[model samples]
Target: MSKIASLVPESLKSSKPSLIRVLNNKYGSDPEMVNLTVGEPDFKTADHVKLAAIKSILDDHTHYPHNWGTPGLRNAISQYLARHFDLHYDPEGEIFVTEGASGAISTIINGLCEPGDVVLVPCPAYTLYRINAELCNAQAVELETSAPDFKVTPQLLKEALDKYGDKVKVLVLNYPVNPTGVTYTPDELRALADLLKNYNVAILDDEIYADLLYEGEHLSMAKLLPDQTLYVNGVSKNAAMTGWRVGYICGPRDVLKALAKVHQAAISTNATMNMDAAQEALLHGDEDTAKMKAEYDRRRKFLMAAMDKIGFEYTKPKGAFYLWVKVPDGFDGDSMAYAEHLAEKAKVAVVPAAAFTKLPVRYFRISYAASMEKLQKAVDGLAKVFAQDQAD
Candidate 1:
């Protein structure tokens, strides 16, 4: 191997792929495997959104667009945020489009972080935050919030701030959080805001699953802490356009200006056609999201009931299509080993909790984004696994 290969940063060289992708790769080709390890929506992009992309193509919109994003798409996103979350952002200087929410997260972390800076990440996190922080030569302090219903509380924030002090540069907040599907109520968001209001840290609020809430309304931290929150969202989850790779970052003009420089250096601009499709999703795709969300709600309910019957312990998810379930009793609390056993014996796939955080956890995350029939098959396999463990 070349010296350049050895010179690659330890963060990138040593990091493992996400557990979701690893399981998908390992069992995706298995004829009998019931893979529920990915957080992707199982819905297709809305036809209208596709048509918008086609229209953009036909209009010869294939050339390079604005570096920030097409003005029309940014305006659409501005309106979407206002309509959905009661948050306002200036489309001209405050909104920027990136490759996807993943890319947006990378940009924000890279932009704001310096060597030795600390990022407060509430676990079980999306996993990417830790990797991103490491890549930026910063440290990720995981404030384990699994005991507080997986929702970050004011007390937790206070404890993290007190310990990390001024070294803390950002707080990565994602809700309808992945893995757990727990979201904060409006009042809860306000309390967090109150605690962080005096702090110097920026809040990178990732609300990519905002449109998929089933129980209560979704609230944006940007509304409460507009000056200090970098709101990240995209059409991947709600519009089922993951391949499109269109996402936006909106925030205070000064902060966005700095983020825009990083974004521009990263990807120059997102694809023109994808931005057109995203514009349609933002402006005219609420019903499309609602339709997909209803199906997800059904799947979530069925999965919750099945987990209960199988004697697995988990909190009922209210937003994202996932369950953070404890390892069934009678088995050693080793999520990776348990997940591999299920994959080999029962032909089911799940992500071990170790993939999300460094905490010694005995839980696995299940994504219910598959069809009802597929979900039923997975439940059947899990039921067998649970019974087999109990018997042994």
Candidate 2:
């Protein structure tokens, strides 16, 4: 084997790069490219949040922070949880701040999953979860939920629990889910929570997009089953603070205490200034989030209308800024082929849905996180190429 290949783990060697990122790197630089492959909000961080970070730096809060995050930020996170999701997690020992939600996810996976353990990942999820699990030498079992609008139902939960039995260590749940933009109602969440209560698995509830809802209120799984759930969230999506790299996890004290070891060993404590910014965002940036979300709603409406005019079918997003568009018959349901043709002929980029699952699917994801102008240009590009496909 080559020296470069030998230096890395077998897992890293065999892993596939994220297709969403690959497409972004390919077309993101072009001035004419209307990139729609990433979920990052196309908005600036709020003034209050930015000012708090500057204040923290000036006040010499740059020294090593507490391993579980500063008390104030933890309290802010706790308050935000209670205010938004009706969940109460004690700041003293129930919350651990990390680099980002991605960091929190890796910390939780490493903290709880031993080698050869099983992790249940639903289809059309953020691909990072599967990558993180596989990198940990754990098996990621994909629960294919293509039939029921890309959601995991109680029957689906029971089947996986019965099959994996005791080997299952974690069940990841992402709502307003990435790529698909699907969320559950309270009754739907209750049914899944009830079925999960009988199992011996841990729940990694990723609710980073909870604040970006377009319609109904967001319901957290942690509220229904707090005992075994590690609630994950951050300011990245909500506050347009993606570059700040601040995220947090909340759960029972004992579990959080145990997980702190992984967080400390991996990345130490999160940057103190970033935590300060996140705290301000949580406490005072509701108007900031609301303004950005309102803009996203506008963009979503325009994009969906454009899809209608271009004859592209997709599930209407209720929360999160993504559209799970079907690979039209002109493309023969080949999502990758359609994405490629769109990129070349129309100068628009999208992510094929197959990357989110282990199996193939006839769908792709278009992030509506861009401006209305860009959405319009992307739709026009689609019309041109789609017209060509029909002509062919």
Candidate 3:
């Protein structure tokens, strides 16, 4: 018998890499590293939310839930959507609670895409969308949104639909975007909705950061195009419940039925305790979310001011806790190199723009999710590095 040299298939070998993990592994263990690479909130889950989870566990709400989700949790998610986005959804038919927002994206990819189907993803997007598309054997056609504003304009959407034609089955839209921290306005969402309506494309709207809008309220594309939108959200960012691993999807009944099949086969169901906890977080955690958002707003102002003083050009982000700043003039525009330089010299770790896509090279993402004191230290470290460069 011939020895098996390579057990994994070529498809698995050719899969896209995880940028967050790559950066984490490179700088995570360094004692002096001030990591601004991760996209998680730095706040703790509120005491009341935690108490609710403990109460649920103590009361023995631990049985297996419905394959779609617990009825109460689904109802809570529906109400949350309606109250926030003014969108109506029948919880029983339209909602499926998943492991996290990442799971929701995976479920949609598996449910919607067949072999060779194309997914339209804007560049500098949350990295998971492209990876999920690849996992489903679908082509992720990344349309660059590195224009004056990092948004997928109606013209760009039209061009992608025309180019990919019938192969394009899904378009991923993330507002309060990771890496870029840009959120779409209601008018902008409506225009894009109209353009997408012309095609048979389905939307995967990841509104995980919807609650962190510093400038104003977040506008959901799903509100305008609910029929074709698979809206994904969760408690991870808003309630600081990343470890709880609870998220949900709401969409048309037929689409949700398909996603339920994929979800059930993959994970069976989300843990009952976590779902119970999430129900509480959704229904009674508004105050917790508000408090965290206020703190994030303060850090946002400080980071933006620091970047300006350091001569870094950046868009004034309206939502999300990130600043996408351009590298200083005369520095090599390669963000990976700059990131490594900062990490080695200044002990500050940030994600490079190249990690998000092959669009431009002058930008890097700084997460303001750390405390103000740590953020201030990072700013001072960065200032010293820039000053040293200027002197040299």
Candidate 4:
């Protein structure tokens, strides 16, 4: 037999490049480069939250935590969920705090999927879902939702269930979606709940951006489909605590028990200080989150107006800090090519829409998580590029 060069399977080798790295390579390293490619909040973590973590460290709370998580943090999560979503979870047996939403998702997939199981993922999805599914030896089946609204309709879900049958064991649901920023209404979620109730599928509900809703109250699938949903959330988006790497999952006791074993084997447990900080965030950081959400709402309006003036068609995102803009007329619809042209010719960097999916050229995603001044400058640069395209 030939010498073994690498243990990784061909599936992992074929995974796509990181979108942030691709944009950075195209835009070159300039301190002045205005980046709209990242989805992280521009705000810093609240002062009180940081202080709490520091206090924990100073008090000698640095020892390894319980394999699942501390009772205090899990209890905070349970209370937060019930208050916000009217969902009930027993903190002692139903919550598993992991490193972050990414970690929680990986643990869930690793536990639920056997080799060749299929996971239904909506296209233009966050990259981690597919990557983790493939890593778990499961198939990532992309269900395209290019209709007027970028949502998975009941009929579409039925079609997928028919095609994949029992092989499709998990459905990943991300509201205020990463690339599209589209959120589901309560009615839409209820419909999805009814349909999934009939199937043997479970949901990995990623609600990290739920608190960033600008138009209306956020709805959680766990509220409607608690028995079948493993809910994942964190303070990263709400309190700008991304660097802390703290998030948790809530579900049925049995489901969480299985996930905890996977989490223990993989991570042992999350950082002790970070969990302390996250507990403080969930209990006392609402005011700071509200302030950041207000700022994001303002930036969203400004970005929407800018896209309108630039003559670009886009779906107005009601939540999250992203705008999914369609490429302008007379331009080749290849988002990567257009994004590169804008980066090189217009000196602005935006993530290509295709990075979120394999689709015909039409749409691109622009993040408004930057300050207003940076957004205005990027729009001005894009205007120049569009004008030059018309001239050509």
Query: Could you say which candidate leads in TM-score?
Result: 1
Index of the highest-lDDT prediction: 1
lDDT of 4 by residue, 1-392 (tens): 44674776887777776776677575646656677888888899888999999999998999988877888898899888887778888988998898889888898888899889999998788888888888777998988887446889899889999999989989999998888888999989989988999998989999999998998667899988888999999888998989899989899998898889988988999988999999999999889989998999999988888878878888879888999888876886588888878777777888887787766647778888889989888989888888889889
Give all TM-scores, in the order shown: 0.98, 0.97, 0.96, 0.96
Per-candidate clashes, comma-separated: 0, 0, 0, 0
TM-score of 2: 0.97
Q: Flag clash pairs in model 4.
A: none
- lDDT tens digits, residues 280-317, model 3? 88999898899998999999999888988987788788
lDDT pick, better of 3 and 4: 3
lDDT tens string, model 2, 38-131? Answer: 8898899988788999999999999999999989999999998889889999999999899989999999998898889999998878888888
Residue 160, candidate 1: Cα error in Å is 1.1
Off by over 4 Å in 4: 1-4, 25-28
**Regions of model 1 farther than 4 Å from truth:** none
Worst 10 residues of 1 by lDDT: 143-152
Q: Model 1 over residues 1-392: C-alpha lDDT tens digits?
A: 88689778877887777777878888888888988888888888989999999999999999999999999999999999888889888999999999899999999999999989999999988888998899888999998886538788899889999998999999999999888988889899989999999899999999998988998878889888888999999999989999999989998999888889898887899889889989999999999888998999998899888888888899778998998898766787588988898898888998988888888878888999999999899889889878888888
Q: Order of all candidates by TM-score, from best down to worst? A: 1, 2, 3, 4
Instruction: List ranges where model 3 is wrong by over 4 Å.
Output: 1-5
Q: What ranking emerges by lDDT with the best candidate at the front?
A: 1, 2, 3, 4
Superior candidate under TM-score, 2 versus 3: 2
